[model samples]
Each structure stands twice: as C-alpha cells, then as structure tokens.
Target: MLEAIDIHADALKRAALTAGPAARVPNCPKWTVHDLVAHIALVHCFAIGLAMNRPAKPAPPPDWEDLLGWWDGQRLALREALGQDPGSPAYSPYPGFDVTVGDWTRRMAHETAIHRLDAESALEEAPETRFSPEFANDGIDEFLTYLAPRLGRKTDIRVTTPERTWSLGEALAEVDGPADDVYRALWGRPHRASVTGDLAPVEAP
Candidate 1:
C-alpha cells in the first residue's frame, strides 16, 4: 500500500513539474498549478504537523511560488512518514476524523488523483490518467461529500450521459454516467455526463 502511495505521489510530482508553477490552473480559476501544488503540499505538512502536535492555523500564502520546492520536499517526507506508518492516528479537518494510516493513505491517494485532473484541465487536455475503481469511486464520493462543501456549491451536480456530454445550465436535465464523470462534472470540467438539476458553477466547479 505504501508502494501504491509512492506511485501516486511520484505521479503527482511529475504532473506538477511538467505543468510548472505559473501555468493558470483552470479548476481554481484564480490559482495557478503552482497554487494547486502548494495547497496540497502545505496540507500534507499541516496534517502531519497537527497529528504531531504542531497545530495548524490558516494564514495567507506569501506567494504560491514559495511552495514549489516545499511541495517537492514535503511529498517525499509524507511518503516516508506514511510508508513507515500509514495507519497511525492523525488529526484531519473533520471534527470526527481521527484518521487511521490506511485512511490517510487512501485520502492522500484520492487527493492526488483528482487534483492531477485539475492539472490536466489546466493544460487543456482531457485527463487520460486514472486510478482503480475503488479509489476513483471513493474519490467520487469524497468529492461530493467533502470537497464539494469546500467549494461552497449549493446543490448536487448530477451527470446524465456517459458518452457524449449533454448540456447543463439550460434546464433541469437528467444526466447519468460513471461516478468519475459525475465527480468531474461537479469539479467544473467539460465532462462526459448528462446533467439535470440546477447546475451552477461553484468556486472550483
């Protein structure tokens, strides 16, 4: 499992490097890929720190560029820490989320997976990268349940078609597809799902 974590982490690092720091990250319209990379790396450190009694408090980023090297180093540190103990008790954002190592590892894997797609979208390509169904589906669920809230979206974003994308924002449409398609639609991609319901773009949507 640690090996698996390494695989995703390495892939994420590659994506960040290839994508670079200043490239505008479309998923987070205001941020660049560097900001995306910085956000995750900082979160990784914050999670480990909070778990180790280093209390995290939100603060301004001096410049997102400052985090590029930090992300590179922290990615390695996180992998090492998780490799040594992926199931250790840890502090997380949710009040009840005293996550286990397995849980943390899964969380991190899912984190990298979805955000990598953000990078792909920033580069203006349909993301060809993916994960196993369990991880991808878990990510789908997590995105809807957790990350969606973070984006401050009001209603559930549903995908109707699995192949050719039907339109959203025209009216209430019945969209259906794989969970990943649903997830990407909600994440603001030009997704391959049909959408019904009130589909308003949210912060990261």
Candidate 2:
C-alpha cells in the first residue's frame, strides 16, 4: 500500500509539473494545477496528523513556488507515520471503520491515485498512467463498500471487469469494462466503461 502511495504521488508530481501551476485540471474543472497540488498536500498533512494523533495547524496553502516541495514533505511524513506500527491506534477519517494506521494507509493510497488522475488530466498530453487490474479492483471495493455509504450514495450498480465483479447498493445498473475503467467511473473520473443504466446516483462525492 505504501508503495502504491509512493507511485501515485510521484506520478502526480510529474504530471503537475508538466501541466504547470496555471493549467486547468480537466477532471476537477474548478481547480488549476496549483489548487490541485495544494489540496493534495493539505490532505496528506491531515492524514499524517491523524496517524500521529496530532492535529495539524490550519494554514494557508503553500505558495506556488513552494507547493511541490511542501507536498513532497507531507508525503514523506505521511509515509513515515503510516509505516509505524500498523496496529497503532489512530483516528479514522471514515466512521464505522478501524482506527488504525492500516486504514489510513489504504485511504491515502486511493486519495493519491484519484488525484493523480486529476493531475494527468491537467496536462495537454495524453495521460499514460495506468492502474493495474488488481489495484483497480481494490479501489473499487474501497469506494463501494466504504465511501459510497458515507456519501449517502444509493446507486444500485453492478460493475463487471475482466478481473472480477462487484455489486454496489442493489445492482440496478450494470457497468462493464476493465477494472480500472470501472474504478475511475465510480470516482467520476474519465473512463471507457459501458453503462446500462443511469450513472448519476453512482457518482462519487
């Protein structure tokens, strides 16, 4: 999981640098690359704080000049915090889940991955990054099983991929494609999956 986090985080940094701070992110339409970078850095810091059982001080986003460096530091801090005893008690961002470093590690990995796609979208070049089938399946399961409920999403969608199939809600709709496509679709990211029903309800929060 830590390796996944590192891979996505580094990829996100590369994409952000290529896009430039002023470039608009296609996936997160309202955000420029600068905004996207700041957001991820802040989130990383927040997760780090949680892992350490220390509340991070609320502060303005890093200046554009320092953004990447600041984010890199936070990412390292998060990795260190999460690399501690996996069973260590920690506050959970999601309710009704284990309050442990393991959960935080999983959350940060997905968070980095989803935003990594956003960074890629900010670039004019075609995004070459890809998620493996197994990784995508785990991401899909994490969203459907944990995030959807928290967001109050009632979408009943059945997702099928070459790797596996999962039922979200009551499975009123079916989306078919590769696991990565299905995973991105659930997160409202660009995907090539085929959908047989309304996808509005299944949209990520």
Candidate 3:
C-alpha cells in the first residue's frame, strides 16, 4: 500500500509538471496547475497531521509569498510521515472506526488517481489513468458508505440530468448524472458531462 501511494503521488506530480503553462483546472476554475499541486500537497499533509494529531499547521493566504515554501514543507512532511511508520494506528472522524497509516496511504493513493484526471483535463493531456478494478471499486464503496452521509439531508439538490430519480447512498447532496459525475458533484466540482439538477445552495452547516 505504501508503494502504491508513492507511485500515485509521483504520477500526480509528473502530471502537474506536464500541464501546459496556460492550463487552468476546470474543476478548480480559478487555479492553475501550480495551485492545484499545492492544494493536493496541503491536503495530503492536513489529513496525515490530523490522523497523527499533529499541531495545527498554518494555511497560507492564497498567492502569498510564502505559499511555495509552505507547500514544499507539507509535501515533504507527508512523504516522510507516511514512509516512517506505515503501520501506526490513527483515528478517523467516522464513528466506530480506527484507521491505520496503511489505510490512509491507500486512501490517498486512490484519491490521487481520480483527481489526476481533473488535473489532466486542465493540462490538455490524456488523463486516461488506469488502476485496478479492486481499488476503484473500493473508492466507490467508501464514498457511498462513509463520506456521503456526512453532507446531511438537503431535499433541494435533486437529480434531473439522468432523467431518473436516485438517492445518494451517503453524502446526500443529490444531483443527476453518471456515477462519475456524481463523484465530482459530491466534491462540488462541475463537469460538462452533467447538467445541473434542481440544486439550491443553503447555508453551510
């Protein structure tokens, strides 16, 4: 699993580097490849830090002078932490669960796989990523089982794109689209493959 994580992270970095200078992430809309890379690194560190109960790290202001340094530090921190002790126990916010470092590593790898596609779209390159059916299927499962319900009920965000009714098994922010579209919509990213359903934003919880 640790090896898998390293491979995915390396792939992501390579993908980011390949992004043309003019590339703009459609999902992130306002961010360039550099910003996306930084965001990914920051998220990587944030998750690991929380799991390890590290002290809260500062989030640099967007476009701040120190942003690059901050991102580099976090990226290295995450890499070192994951490598040092992949078997350490960690707590997750999910009820009735204790996720180990191995679990987090795998999770990050799977996440990087999907996001790589979005990054690729911004780069005008083929994000045609490949992963085992086992990993992709597990990601779909985890999203349904653990992540979805956290969004709570919002009767307004109905699915109209698929022209059929469906409910999120969890993460109840409903929308109409292919399963893949649903995946992005869950993350609040827009994809042309989807048409907006009857969604109305309410106050954040």
Candidate 4:
C-alpha cells in the first residue's frame, strides 16, 4: 500500500503540475487542480494525526503556489507514520471500524488513486496509468466492505471484473468489465464497464 501511495502520488503530482493549478478538474467539477491538491494534502494530514495518535486540528494548506511543497512534506510525514506497526492502535475517522495503521493505509491508497485519476483527467492524459489486478481487487473489496453500504444502496447488484466478482445485496443486476474500470465505476468515475441494470445502487453518493 505504501508503494501504491507513492506511485499514485507521483502521477497525481505530475498531472497537477502539467495541468497547472488553475486548471479545472472535470471529474471534480467544483475543484481546480489546486483544490484537488489541497484536499489530498489535508487528507494526508488527517491520516498522519490519527496514525501518530495526536489527532491535532488540521492546518490550512498554503497558498496555491506552495501547495505542492506542503503536500510533499505531509506525504513524507504520513509515509513515516504509516511505516510503523500496522496493527498499532490509532484513532479512526469512522467509528466502529478498526483503528489501526493498516486500515488507514488502505484508505489513503484508494484516496490517492482516485484523485490521481482526476488529476490525469484534468490534463487530458491517456489512461496509461492503471492499477494492477491484485491491487484493484483489493480496492474493490475495501469499497464494498467499508464504503458501499454508507451510500444507502437498496438494489442488489453483482459486479464482475477480470480479477474478481463482488455481490452487493442480492445480485439483482450486474456490472462487468476490467478490474480498473469496475473499481473506477464503483467510485462514480468515468469508466468503460457495462451495466445491465439500474446503477443507482452502486453509484457513489
């Protein structure tokens, strides 16, 4: 997961730099590249706080020009924090979930990956960057297990990918495609998958 974070963060930074701070992100309509960078930066800080058991109040990000530098520092700090014992107790942003560095590491990996796609989209880059099947499958499981039910989905749906299949509810409908596409689709990002029934159940809230 640390490796995933590093790879995605690098790609995200490259895309954000090439697109420039003011460039608007189509996927995140309300945010420009600067906003996107700050959001991810802030998320890193939040994760850092929890991992260190400090839970300090979040500091505002620097000006757009300095955002990247700030993000790099926070990223390094977060990496350090997460490098500690994965099973060590840490505060959780969500109640009732495991409060451990491992969980937060997984969350940050997905968070960075999703935003990496947004950054690449802002630059009109090709989809050359893709997650491995193993990683993508794990991401799918994380979403379905930890994030999906929060969306208040009602319909039963089966999502199938080259790497794995996930059944949410009772499998009344089906979505089939490559692992990356299915993962992105579940996150409400543009994808190339095919949906055989109403997709509202699987859409991100």
Candidate 5:
C-alpha cells in the first residue's frame, strides 16, 4: 500500500507541476489543477490524522501558487503515519467496524492513484495508466468488500478481469474488462467496459 501510494503520489505531483494550477482537469470538470491538488492534499492530511488517532484542525486551502509545496509536506506526513502499526485503532467513517491504520493505508493508495489519473488527464498528453495486477485486483476487492456493502446493494455481481474473477453477493450481473479499467469503473470513472445482466450503476462514495 505504501509503495502504491508513493508511486501514485509522485506521479500526481509531477502531473500537477507540469499542468500548472490553472489547467482544467478533464475528469473532474468543475475543478482546476489547483482544486484537484488541494483536494488530494487535504484528503492525505485527513487520512494522516485518522491513522495517528489525532484530531487535526481544519486547514485552509493552500495558495494556488504554492499548492505543490504544501501538498509535498502533507504527503510526507501521510506516508509517515501509514508506516505505523496497521492494527492500531484508528478513526474510520464506516460504522460497526474497527478500521485500522492499514485500512486507511490501502484506501489512500487507491484514492491517490485515481486522483493521479485525474491530474494526468489535465496534461496535454495524458500518461499511460498502469496499475500492477495485484494492486488493481486488491482495489477491486476493497471496493467490493468495504464500499459496496455500505451502499445497501444486496444484489449479486460478478466481475471478471484478465487476471482473476470474483463475485459480490450472488451474481445477478457480471462486469468484464481489464483489471485496471474494471477498478476504475467500480470507482465511478468512465470506462468502455461491458456490463451484462441486472445491475445498478456503481455509485461513487
């Protein structure tokens, strides 16, 4: 998770730096590069506070001109917090579960990766999207296990990727695509993947 976070965060920083704060993000139509950077930085700070069980005062958004530097500091702090014991009790938005530091670590990794893609989309030529099969597979698992249940969807859905196949509930529907695309689709990103059978649209949290 830490490695994934590092890779994605670095890529995101590069994209933001290259695009400039004024550039508009294609994926997040309403946000400029500055807003995307600020959003991810704030999320990292929130995750860090959760992992360390520390209550943090809300921080004002960084100046667009200095957003990169501010994000760098927040990313460093988040990485440090994620290195702590995974089993340590931490604050989680989910109820009826004792979410741990490790949970936040994994969540933030995917979170950062997705936003990195959004940042890359702001570039003149977007970078190729790549995720290790393992990380992509786990991302699918995390979405199914941790997030889907919260949506009150009891219907079964089967998802297939080149590397593996898995199902949620009883298999009322099936989604098939490359692992990375499937992961993105599950996260509410636009994709050309095919979905068959009876299944409601996957909503982003």
Candidate 6:
C-alpha cells in the first residue's frame, strides 16, 4: 500500500507540473486536471478518516498549489492507520466484505494508482502502467470476489498474464493481457480489447 501510494503521489505531482490545472483528463472527461486533483485529495481524506474510525466529515478541497501537500498529509495519516491490527474494525462502504483497516489500505492504494494514471493521461504522456505482480494479482482476486458478483453472471472466466493465470466462475469467458492492462480493463477502463472473454461489461463501483 505504501509503495502504491508513493507511485500515485509522484505521478500526480508530475502531472500537475506538466499539464497544469486546465488540462482535461481523457479517462475522467468531466474533470480537468485541477478537478481531478481535488477529487483525489478528498478521497484520500475520506479513506484515511474511515480507516481511523473517525467521522466522515468532508474536508474542504485544496487549491492547486496546495493539493500535493494536502494529499501528502492524508497519505501519512492513512499509513499510520493501516499499521494497526489488520482485523481492527473499520467502516467500509462495502460492508459485505467485513473490511478492516488493512483492506482499506489495499483499496485506497489501487484507487490512488488508477487515478494517477488518469492524471498522467491528461498530460498525453502516460507512463507504462505497472503494479507489482503480487499487487496486480491480489487486485484481480478482490475484483472477482467483491465486484464480479454484482454482474449477476455465473459464466466461466479466465484471466491470464505473463506472470500468472486465474480461472474464475463456471463459464468460458477469457481475458488475457499484461497484468496492469488487465487490471485496468477489469476496473472498467476502456482497455477491454486487451482481453478476450465472454464477460459482460461491468461499471466500476
């Protein structure tokens, strides 16, 4: 989670420097660079607050110049919260998972990473999307366990990458690509062509 957070923070910082506040993010068409930064900052605050078992009071969004610093502080608090017992009770919007602080750490890591990619795409110079093999694999598992059930399809599913292969459900749908690309596709990004499967399209939660 810490590593993912570092990568996410760095990417957004670079985007802010290169694209400025007015650039449009292709993946998040409704938000400009500034809006994207503000959104993520608020997310960080919300996630950290939840992990700490704090009230869900919303924080005021920061200006562009202070955005990075605000995010840095939130990230630090989240890391501290996550360092506590993994089984510690926490509030998750997805209560079906009985999520804890540790789960929030992983969820926020991916959340930040994906949005980081969005920020980079706004600059028209997106870096290669990469995640540790383990992190990517775990993300896939989480999606299958928590998110896929909502698709209401019991079709067999196969997902493969250079590092590993995962067979899920009972139907014969298949998806194959680099781990990062597959992850993005599964998260409702427009990278579905990277995968070949009978899976129905599902929107990200």
Candidate 5 vs. true structure, TM-score: 0.90
Tens digits of lDDT, candidate 5, 111-193: 89989999999999997787877888898888788766755545378899988888766687788998888888777676766
TM-score ranking, best first: 2, 4, 5, 6, 1, 3
Which tens-of-lDDT digit does each residue in 1-205 have in candidate 2? Answer: 9999999999998998898999999999999999998898888999888988786864435688777777777878888999998889987656676577877788889999999999999888856778999899999888877667766787588888997887756777888898889889888898899988788787786
Please list all clashing residue pairs in model 6, or write none if there are none.
Answer: 155-171, 156-170, 156-171, 174-197
Q: Give the poorly placed runs of model 2, Cα more than 4 Å off.
A: none
Worst 10 residues of 5 by lDDT: 196-205
TM-score of each: 0.67, 0.91, 0.62, 0.91, 0.90, 0.82
lDDT of 6 by residue, 1-205 (tens): 7677777777776876799889998988888988888887788789877887784765645676677678678768777877788779887565454668777777777778778878888877677767776877777766766546644435367788788787765536677887777788777665643556545543354
C-alpha lDDT of all candidate models, in order: 0.59, 0.85, 0.57, 0.84, 0.82, 0.73
Q: For model 4, how does the per-residue alpha-carbon lDDT over 67-87 read when each residue is reduced to its tens digit?
A: 777888999999999999989
Error of 5 at 182 (Å): 0.4
TM-score of 3: 0.62
Q: Where does candidate 4 stray beyond 4 Å?
A: 150-155
Ranking 1 against 6 by lDDT, winner: 6
The candidate scoring highest on lDDT is 2
Worst lDDT 10-window in candidate 3: 196-205
Residue 25 of model 3: what lDDT?
82
The residue-by-residue lDDT of candidate 1 on 14-98, one tens digit each, is 7666777788877678878777776777777765554444456533255655566666666676776566465567655556445
